[model samples]
Target: MKSTDIFLEILGCPSEEMHEPVNAGYICPYTSDRCSKRGHGTNDPFPVCSIWKYTGARENRRKDRPVIVCPKRFYTADIVGDILEHVWVGPYERNKINAVREIKMGKIGNVDMVVCDTSNLPALDNFVSVELQAIDITGTVSDVYTSHLSQTDLIRSPKYNFNTANVHKRYLTQLIKKGYFHSTWRKKIVAVIQDVLFESIRERVRFAATNPKDENTSIVFMSYTLDPTETDEEGYYRLKLKEVVGTEHSVLMNAVVYETPPSKDLFVAAIKRQL
Candidate 1:
């Protein structure tokens, strides 16, 4: 029933002053301070931590799900605990989890975060990699944000579409390449994302059937959703763990690197039409 919502917070600041500067404070659980990210062309912080998807393609409006646009929003929930249960971290208990951010691997590239057993530090052999991703938005939500700041109603919903294509073209390879490397050490890498993203991925690519419990598995996917019914003292909905599944390097390999192509005749027919 609800539609067109802009979810922004000034942390401990009163709800009435949300549109104004966060005079009281603006602390992020991840950064333990104000959100590190700043909006383009302005020093003002990007106000959208998340938003309710009201207007979009017919298929996208099925549930009016809460879209997690910021990576830090994932930090509000117990995502680490959820990952620990499935990752193949050797002897890394909850207390021993030493999370290092943006650690660079030689050629494979920088991983989002690496969870390690501090007890096994120096060597750092006992660890699992982590990649936290929120879907990239196509159009700017600045219009909606401005409207909220003015406390004026919006005449129309601007295009704030989620860039689902990145799931295949951009992020998929990062997972496969890194997942394969982690597999070599007999460790698992976790892909942390929201439900909307995971659903879009599965629809586009075929997933290989595998269990996270299986020692051979290399990739783990942890999907989450916001619980519309539950809210904290701040009145923001609580994020709940919805599902966790694991796959292997090969499963992800098939996602983009290798795929079945259309028949040659079909290609020729399309070329003929263009000619």
Candidate 2:
């Protein structure tokens, strides 16, 4: 689907754009020959009124520089001293909006970029902790045993401390505190398990004395098994599992639905359509 369609579905309108320019024709550019104030900007050399100034870069301009114009109301404000909203239109524009999140577990740090919708803000608050499991059917533990030896030595290898000051953990915390995740508790739990399993695999790799050179490479393959519901001493509700056997890493990662603000014209049009 077109990104714009997704945008409209989420934000309910087009994305807002600022600083467009409009052309003036066959009249006093300043007031378009309708102004009662003759003294203001009347001496301006440009054919287009100073009030209707072009705000776009030369690259953004059409063949006619006067083609670029901001909203009439925004320009009128310069004379009448009133502020109004502005808008723009382009077919191929890519909206550059996203949410950045960071999560850390002992020695492992993760940064995730989540794209947002222009309409939904509340969805940003929910996420599921995904846990992964390594697929090994040997039962003989030969490969597991070989890897375990190598992992031990690697864990003791020197490592730089990671920076995580800007990471926002509130989203995960709120999801757990609120009940929105209750609907997907089983899925959430499986996700949490995946995280724990990965951490375990990492720890095992660190235990292996062999250095893989780059720390960023994945040492093992893992996958998720969805378990959306859990029942226990605490009354069962949708739950995001937090622990796996013995590990310090938090398996809880949040999933959020995001949105951008609607375009000014689309917003106004919607209001008019309703009225």
Candidate 3:
């Protein structure tokens, strides 16, 4: 099936264009275009406005510059969630897809996305944690620096070094803190990364999956490529999951228990000085 079909099935197409007459005394926040109505309304949750389109088009016209503002930026998370639901969960699993954007787990800080079963009361069981990273990994150092020093700098910067130890550390930290490694329920962590970035860290991912300190947890890596040539009817770039790799111990890693530290606040003080 065409990639567009998958997107359409999961997200549905954008709502048809609204042709409602503008209310009197209405002004466009973006372009200052006067409207016949006081407010604007559209059936589509994500309505395409002329301002965004024009800006994106203008940015794309610059051959030497990076196109930072595009439709893919907005729908990437939704697309990933849909792909996970269809490809990983499938119809047989009695699971509900939940996309938690920035949930905090102890010291691990904010996690990207998490999918879990809704039928189960305790949402931690039978879940998958996904981290999505989308960036142009092919740009030369100079090109990247010119576009935005902050964009790809994390991958090579001395402090962040995103591709090397940081990726594994962050992923493992999230898995451990989320109880994915310690829970007695089925749990998996998937990292959805761009193809170029995935290649740079494929070795690390393999090593981590192969030699997980905690034998009970498994990590899966899925790489996606955006086809510059292929776009949907809406002119949005098409994305394809190029590859998926998981460790041989994936099955064995299920339902293993890992101990967690005691909460200091929950326990009584060791000594009472002067009650």
- On lDDT, the candidate that comes out on top is 1
| Better model by TM-score: candidate 1 vs candidate 3 | 1
Candidate 1: worst 10 consecutive residues by lDDT?
Answer: 7-16
Summarize candidate 1's per-residue lDDT along 109-189 as a digit string, tens digits: 888787777775577667778888887788776766666667777767666678989766888888888888878888888
Candidate 1 vs candidate 3, lDDT winner: 1
Model 2 is weakest, by summed lDDT over 10 consecutive residues, at: 79-88
Best-to-worst TM-score order: 1, 3, 2
Go through the candidates in order and give each one's C-alpha lDDT: 0.71, 0.23, 0.40
Write one digit per residue (lDDT tens) for candidate 3, span 231-271.
56555445666666554233322312232446665554533
Clashes of each: 0, 45, 8
Tens digit of per-residue lDDT, candidate 2, span 1-20? 11111111011111111111
Question: Where is model 1 more than 4 Å wrong at Cα?
Answer: 1-17, 21-27, 38-40, 55-63, 89-93, 120-123, 232-236, 260-269
Collision count of model 2: 45
Query: In model 2, which runs have C-alpha deviations exceeding 4 angstroms?
Result: 1-136, 139-191, 194-199, 207-275
Model 1 clash number: 0
Error of 1 at 199 (Å): 0.8
Q: Give the TM-score of candidate 2.
A: 0.14
lDDT of 2 at 263: 96
